[model samples]
Target chain A: MKTPWNRFDFLLLPLLGGAFILLLWHLSSHSWSGDLPDPAKTWHESKPYVLEPWAKRGELDQGILRFTFLSLILVAKGYAIALILGTPIGFFLGLSPTFNKAFDPIIQILRPVSPLAWLPLGMVLFAKIKGINVTEVAALFTIALCSMWPTVLNTAVGVRAIPTDYLNVARVLKLSRWKTLTKVMIPATLPYMFTGFRLSLGIAWLVIVAAEMLTGRPGVGGFLWQQYNALVYEQIILCILTIGGVGFILDRLMSVIERRFKTI
Target chain B: MSAHLELFNLTKVYPSKKGPQTIVRDFNLQIPKGEFVSIIGHSGCGKSTVLMMVAGLTTVTSGGIILAGRELSGPGPDRGIVFQSPSLLPWMTARENVMLGINQVFFTATEQERAQIAEYYLSVVGLADFMDKRPAELSQGMRQRVGIARAFALKPKMLLLDEPFGMLDSLTRYELQQVLIDLWRRNQITTVMVTHDVDEALYLSDRVVCMTDGPEAGIGEILNVPLPRPRDRKAILELPEYHRLRATLIEFLEVRAHHRPNSSNSPSGAATPPASVPVSA
Candidate 1:
């Protein structure tokens, strides 16, 4: 039973809508009295940046690709640290009512606080570490702190929501604790954990951009800030588009991994 | 021989907001080896509770269960349970679900032997071709078959079924009943089933034990079905004793049981008997 809206319809509708928005932007920029760079002019000005994306001419004048790669590495490091630290904590919280009751309120209070708000504290803490790049460390800390909540909360919820029937089956089989944890608990909780991972990765990416911008690190967000200070509207628009594209790709990659590993 | 399975003064009391509520009170039953016994009663009569206690999935408030002269403490591989829901792990294939039980119970067996045992039981349940299918892909009947196969694959000394086919359609239910009977006959395991259907009890069990309604439900009657072995469904229906027994069971459930003279009516005493009228020929 094929419906009127098919796969092609879904694909074509979004593409058409994006094209319409681009056309409207081009028209509005051209008609407006202000110095909003028209689409054509912005494209022409940013052509060199796009073509030589991997070039590294200077610290602040690095190519767009180099900036994107640097930003991605920071996000990856922060996100990895968050996953390693948060997973076991979440598992324990999920398994024990006592732990959850004692700590859940603290988590709730911290979760809603913005990553940008922690920037000052991160800078102060990381500056005293003495060896590595302090600003980069601050940026990484901000990203990790912001992104760790989703994984913790989601893992806890997943563990708590395991169907009682599975536990009954475990009892009937008299499986050892290790076997129950590995075979039933882990496999059952994986889909929910992946959901948390996807959300955490998104938070990591978003936080890295803002953190780098504030810290003046050599990343895409820093490059955007430099361009903004230099009054380069075209480069700022280019940076926005690059960030959006990369974020979309990162989300898609997470989905691919999720599909590959999903057990239930 | 000593009783293969025995329950002595078993009870289950749940702590409620009002006070402690007794679901089952001082229940006792015994079954010899390879015998089939079915428990039937109105809903909320603690029939399933008794089955769970025997399976060691539920904590008994008082008393204990004995299997083959050993006092039962907790769930183990010696007993296998088929729950009302298929309860197959949805992520695993039918074969894998059965193999999980086989592997755990027969830990000393080689992987090849475990696989063979799983395959054999699945084939016995007429699911050989669909062994690789996940629970979601299979029909309800097929999924229940997988559960049955999983339980049987363990080769447990005793089997417990808690309304195993209560959710199935009549056709599927009849088919699975025959399959279960065949397996039970072949394996000769001491089996106890909880059911609401009188005809099903008569068809499959050596004895049918009826329970009164709860809070504090107890055994009302136990009727022995002395029909011959390998009983055909149509042939059994033709027997005069079959009609008489069915009428007696229904009379007790509908008229006599609900109007107990001295029984105190608790707030939760509105439990209804199952709507399983005998089908006419």
Candidate 2:
């Protein structure tokens, strides 16, 4: 078999792949999708988002980084809730077959439910907000509901997959139930939990965009929606690039956190 | 020596579609305190089952285990168990894995004392320099060394080793067995190890209990090792009694053990002990 990639061409191949995508985008804009600006034109128009990343003028208008920070805050809140609430539930599901039987079907039915569909329910659940906007509270609720499944499912799987030998070690040592959980269960399940967290984070990020679009925050999703409404496709390109870049950074940070835990 | 650990009519039966297949039937042994005991048998002869039952990792289907005048109910820190492959948590370093037990058993001890305890046992297992390395960073032998350290650090009343060096190469196994025997000599904790290695059984055990083939395996014969303490491998090899015992263990394994039923569902094959067993050393 022949390969397009050389054995040692790791970075060069990926860079070339990026160039190929740019060329396609440039070609597509020139022909079939004439309304959208080419990469060069879009880059010229979207330079301000890069030059001054954190700027705020109105409740609905902000620079890219400010919008990203808001999006990050929203995802962080929801992901924290998911990690806190969903992790224990997963531990139970893995440890107790009765609990798994009781909740597995419910989770399976709910896990694949479109995250956007949870938005209206989030709206109903948090209809009355004290200081914050109702839509903002609802959107927060939506992010939590949507992002928690991966963590819950992955944690359960991780728990189930813990080697019996480890459990035996726990037993043979007469580890108190709490110590067993903290030492044996948590450490063994962490890699899986992190996998779940990364996925949950991804979902949270995805949900925030849609939630912000509907809820009207000065976040990336909100900005992208605003650009769409204003027919400013060039700024939409900026939002896309910013969203991708931030998501990459978030994943990298998660890996760093995983490594940190691994040494403990 | 008076018995410190007693298994009276110990049995284990696992249920299958056909029936409840008995793995160990009416198996019995009594070990004095500070004794190193090995259960030697062919694979799947329920030697590990007996060890696990003693460790209380596996629930005893029938009968009871009495340890130090108390009826053993469930697994506790009093029994330190090392499995076939040491299952150290991938996230924790070797020191942390050892410390996991130290923190629990010695909860009242000072933080510094606990750290010292971990360091002390890790050094005993020859992992002083590698204590900071995680299980993933360690070799198979080194990881097993960590397991040994973790178990020994608990200061358990009994130590159970289920083929602790089963996964290691011949050289690694020999070195670890030496390490294990040295540790056992220091504390002389009542220990039960399951192994197929005749040399291992003879080297480390005060008594070697040969088990028959399974589906109802029980004690076939129990051999006492008259070999002196602080055993040297080459020195033991020179002793006439050592080779005789080794040959006997190897003989039981090759001849009598083959009578047990294969997985093909031949109950009749196992039912008739002293029947035709074609294999021999």
Candidate with best TM-score: 1
TM-score of each: 0.91, 0.86
Residue B72 of candidate 1: its Cα lDDT? 95
What is the TM-score of chain A, computed separately for every candidate?
Answer: 0.91, 0.90
lDDT of 1 by residue, A143-193 (tens): 888999989998999999999999888888988899899878888898888
Q: Candidate 2 chain A: worst 10 consecutive residues by lDDT?
A: A255-264
What level of docking quality does candidate 2 show?
Answer: medium
Write the residue-wise lDDT of candidate 2 on B59-139 in tens digits. 999999999999998788888888888888777889988988898899999999999999999998999899999888899
The models' CA-based lDDT, in order, is: 0.87, 0.85
What DockQ does model 1 achieve? 0.72
**DockQ leader:** 1
Off by over 4 Å in 1: A1-16, A19-35, A260-263, B259-281
lDDT of 2 by residue, A193-220 (tens): 8888888888888888888888777799
